[model samples]
Target: MLYKLNLEHILFLDIETVPESETFEQLDDVKQELWEHKTQYQRKDEFTAEEFYERAGIWAEFGKIICISVGYFTSKGDVRNFRVTTFHGAEAKLLKEFKNLLNSHFSKPNHLLCAHNGKEFDFPYIARRMVIHGINLPYKLDLFGKKPWEVPHLDTMELWKFGDYKHYTSLKLMANVLGIPSPKEDIDGSMVRDVYYNNGDLDRIIKYCELDVITTAQVFLRLRNEELLSDNEIVRI
Candidate 1:
């Protein structure tokens, strides 16, 4: 018998990244040196990893974590149930803990991980960082290795292709178009590094991550209702 997808098996996640701060200036120096060394792709204002680290801040600096947030949705019938979890801490430790949590709490091996543009950014970022921290990735994230339609993935941006991929759209824009209330407000991905660096407010970063997860969930619902759902009903988890 063919198995049906269960509501409990869907996980929606998001992440925020920033450059390291302590080595900020040192990074800039390295960038300048490298730019001087490389003739091609070099310019008067061109920056190296070191320079960018100094100017833009490295992802490892500014407390390490940046932010990681996840959303879980369980659908029953006309209402969708939602729960969110967020983590903020040193980059290495937080990522390790996040991996551990995934392994211990949600390691069913059958769960579907969902995110907007996740295949391109969020998922790969997490995997690469986890490997850097000496942690094993809990699941396979190599979408490129799978057949175009066979990959067990969903990107809201991809769904918009039904409309001819008309204009590029963001999660925030999609939520607005679908009448879904976005919790992002004034905070956005671009402001994440500054918010964590300048204000040192981890709470805001956590909230910001939560908002992205929630927005992603909303987008998932919109797509399900329009194309996947057999009826106009949301099942509460």
Candidate 2:
């Protein structure tokens, strides 16, 4: 099925998010209460809400995307290049830029958005954040009333599952087992919040996110039984 689709028609992406504020105390009393209630099941008396705030970035309501790195393939004859770019800075501003990119470039019915665990995480998180910012949903991101088959989104994690809904796979695990290079170097998802909030290193986060995008595109190619991209084939802009 993957071989049937043109690689250029799919936009591969990864996002880095952090809690909206630096600390739990930054959230007002109402939000603090909601946070505690929202995470009760996940926390399960193991940690207080304040202690668990480090993970707030996983939830769109409590988090904001700091970077969105996207990559896409452009093939010329036998040669293929994967070009990646990142949108960073303020959440609303970056989201608007991302929405514009989707609306202008990837609005075609055949153009799909691809990500690892996207359906479960990245895709919905982007949509939810866009709505929160009052940004109109681009055609690619808006899924309202669309039949499952009509949704123009692809998830590598879902593809890896292949039918076992009970199974879950992290991107690193998938890359490792597939012999694709690991994207992680200085930090991982667990450290993104601190990297952004404490270290004040947006560039580092952007680099990490872009690497994930490249890795995701590589994983997709591997799944399609295609050749992996070489270092020279990856161009970041």
Candidate 3:
């Protein structure tokens, strides 16, 4: 079935990131640094952390992730419904919990980790933060030396290109174009950092992350049906 791609081995994951600021004073320093960084980028001045944050777009403020959501899919008799799990907390705590969850759930080497832009963002961010927390990544995440297309990863964004490579489309935009209703339409990526930083609303972040996972899974199902398998068949999870 479309959902049965290596049934015992598929994990769809997404993350929500925010600017890091513990207090008002710290936020001021970060804002100053970010401002200087932006000025430098506009003037083509010397580059530094200050300038880097300013020009890095959404990656400014070090992108403190507040939520990590995962969805697991396996083939059942005529349908493909995925089970979703979420982890939310402080940046360090969430990283620790995410690594622990990965280790506990994916102890084996065969389980495949999937994400939309995971290769560029989700996967690397998780790996770096795991190392920061002195945690070892699960073996399934050992995608360092593999070629982009050869890796077990299934990036929906990459698949959407369909060999065109004209422009990079966001998950929300792709959902819109494909006529799929995105649960994330109300909470765009640009508001993610602010919502987490200002509101301290972890639930919002988790919901946002889950929406991305759902969209990614929907795209995956579409791709699988088109190129790999049909939807009516069944495979064990």
TM value for model 1: 0.73
lDDT of 1 by residue, 1-237 (tens): 012556567778888777555454544565545434542343346755444443332223222446688877556676656777876677777887777767776666566677887766677777777766777666545454567555555566766766674556788888888888656366877777777777877788777777777778777766666332222232322
Estimate candidate 2's alpha-carbon lDDT, on a 0 to 1 scale.
0.93
Rank the candidate models, highest TM-score first.
2, 3, 1
**Order of quality (lDDT):** 2, 3, 1
Once fitted onto the true fold, the runs of candidate 3 whose alpha carbons sit more than 4 angstroms away are: 1-4, 22-61, 75-79, 107-109, 145-150, 164-166, 226-237
TM per model? 0.73, 0.98, 0.74
Tens-place lDDT per residue, model 2, 116-149, is: 9999999999999999999999998889999999
- Tell me how many clashing residue pairs each candidate has: 24, 0, 2
lDDT of 3 by residue, 1-237 (tens): 345667547788998765455432455665766555555655464565543442233352344566788877655675655677788776678777777867788656566688887767887777766666676666656666767654666677877777876668887777677766556256767777556656867677677778677778777766665332223332222
